[model samples]
Target: MTAADGSRLYGSDASTADQREALLSGEVPVAVYGLGKMGLPLAAVYADVTGDVVGADVDEGVVEAVNAGECHVESEPGLSELVERTVAAGAFEATADPRAAAERAAIHVVIVPTPITDEKEADLSALESVARDVGAELDTGDAVFVECTVPPRTCADLLEPMLAEEAGHDAFGLAFCPERTASGRALADIRGAYPKVVGGVDDESTRVAELVYGELTDNDVLAVGDATTAECVKVFEGLYRDVNIALANELATFADEIGVDVNEAIETANTQPFCDLHDPGPGVGGHCIPYYPYFVINGFETEAPLLRTAREVNDSMPAFTVNTLAREVRAEGGDLADATVAILGLTYRPGVEETRATPAGPIAEELAAAGAEVVAVDPLLDDADEFVAEMIPQRALYDPDRDLDAVVLVTPHEAFDDIEWERFDPLVVVDGRQYLDLSDTDHRVYTVGSGVTSAGRAESAEPHRDANLAAEVER
Candidate 1:
């Protein structure tokens, strides 16, 4: 078969249907490109299926780890053992060369990162680079599937033409299969939980792509209209999340002004069964939520007014957090210029080491830029001071003798839930994520979008007096 660009899309012997049947009968050669969080776990799944799985990555360390029967990315139970067994059986291997891997495999799954530029433009350099590499070595009948979050037209607009031009085919069998695997539970979700979305450049492409994914996942695969629609499905899923988070953030702010607890109200609202509301926090973070919408808006020239507004609201959260902390500092009779502020939580969210698009990084950088001596802490972060230089470990949040102007809780890590607020001699708490209980604390505590007052009798009288005066003046 050939693609529109006159390239041999797939070889006569490389049948996706045959591969699928072989996968069911336990005989398929699958190569997964990019060994980051998503690709590594996917490779492990194919490994478990006893299929010939080639894990390819540009990073030599990751490739070496996979070849040594070690999993580079953290995943669910039994992944290490599966990788080890697969390596021992010669069923799995890792390589840095894409062409070599492509030559040896009947199915290629591209899982490269599709991040956005500072101007909110889709940086398809990495994806394009991979496409060029794959195109140079693609054979007829070999199926190539893209499983990254991208704009609706990316696969058809960029990938199809690139592959066709590189391989000299008219219409190659190509498909877009967006992955819905959650970060932490990727191993389980990839194997069974989330259903797959498969869309092809044409009908034959769709069938072959479905066959490839069906072997690894037990969940149902829904075939969409075409590649563009499949691409939209991924972006829509993420944009939907961004919009809901913005709504929650906006409502949380309103709830604070009206003396209503947003969390409690959301709980009540969720009882209706149809109104499922996501919780608001310091802001939306992570790779997909923060970056994917920009691609959708930019790629399609679609007027996503609400989505655009939501992006603004979420992006502005860091500055808002810093401003809120500044107010708390002022309440303690201290200005940011001379105050030493301690920030709690550095990771974007809880329980993950991923810092991509993490709001805490920008928040800390902004605070430093505003002349505040910022000290950051996160339980998951070891050697935190070195990782970002401005951050410190949770245990070293404050020097006992040096009075802290404020402690900003940016991430709601469970460990922070039990902290004794009395430790800081003169502390003003800003709960950015609404994670802490300020009801019993003696320190004056303020939360993002929530007006929860603290009940604390401070040992230092002068600061408390100034704080009360500032509170009165602001009202």
Candidate 2:
């Protein structure tokens, strides 16, 4: 894959014709660093598209898994087959050594994690480590693209100068094209459900990126003015959700007092063009939505009162959910201190194995702290020891002889459809997703953001009800 000068034929300065031929003919080596959930699918897609790709990661386990033609990220449709085909065909390989991958590939893609620190600062350690390694073996005219979501100005200000200082000689491409994909739908999203956003440090860098992703993706490639703008584009997308979800959660509390069904109302109101409100749940979970607000809240000097407040509102959801459950349970003569509470779902998103920043963790902690024996049910997780909660198989949750108190449906995973609420017949069933139809059942049920039903109020000793909820329900 080298020219007469022993350099990559597809370096930044090669003529358009030569670069195009090399990329299309599988002569130019393409490397995707960070063989993770997002990175693996991206690497597979790149290999399937270019017929030559390498995957690099710090974890030797991931490297071994990939090289053996085995996939570590499950539930992503078509990923296993893609990985098998790519590995067997010799178009893809995984390595623990970043320098080896960097030295071989002309097009380097970095998709490492950019976790936020406890102080809310962007922890660019992984990104920087990969950058340093890639720079040490830097070649002229190579292109390095970062798909990791980062704060604004990270690509140009921090990454560009760092790579330049390391390279010292030949030029390479540095761009931030944030990986905009969810866990289950990564392959489809990357192949082309959405257009690719590419913003490079310079005009030439942008042009080179446009050429690469344009050939790789079925969708059009958008070239932004610079890298920071591209970073803002991704951050803005996440910030919008954080704020919208906070608004929904806030309205949910008000709905209980006013006797309104926030979920029903949200669905009805969303029929219009400009009204797309997110669902109100126990809380916003997952790595992206909960933390992206910090980019503005902590990174910038601007007064972001609303952003801060929204985070507070979302963060309070787990405890709020617990309080709601506790109130109903106490009204039924069951104390959370001795109650056997079942947390229905553990993952942040349904059908996905990721539990990063999931609300279930906090909810379980609060319940256990209150002296409740919490048994979490999620088919995706073998054991939830990380959350310090006991794991119970979903089918076993329906054992006729088992005794339980309250049931909190957190994630609304599809497997919960078959649960017989009466089997665990004792206290209240709180639906955080608001989609469960427990109204027909004999058990008292409370849907978050909705007023307690007559069925729930009937469980009380008298006609007495929660004062705030009394106005919304009839006698």
Estimate candidate 1's alpha-carbon lDDT, on a 0 to 1 scale: 0.74
lDDT of 2: 0.81
Model 1 ranges with Cα > 4 A deviation? 1-19, 24-27, 75-77, 384-387, 390-402, 456-475
Query: What is the per-residue lDDT of model 1 for residues 1-475, given as tens digits with 9 covering 90 to 100?
Result: 0112211224345455554456644444677888888888888887677447787899999999999999876634666787888788877899998778876666678999988987888998888888888888777666789998877788888889899999898446889998888777888888879788899998889977776677678889889999999998988899889999888876765554465677778878999979988877777788899998888677665687888899878877777666666766665677877877788887787777677778887777767877877776677775544546643322355344556777788877777766666666656777877678766556777776665465754322222124543353233
Best by lDDT: 2
lDDT of 2 by residue, 104-155 (tens): 8888999998889989888889999998888887788778899989989998
Using all chains and alpha carbons, the TM-scores for the candidates as numbered come to 0.87, 0.92
TM-score, cand. 2? 0.92
TM-score of 1: 0.87
Pairs of residues at least 3 apart in sequence or in different chains that clash in candidate 2: 12-141
Rate residue 138 of model 1 by lDDT.
76
lDDT of each: 0.74, 0.81
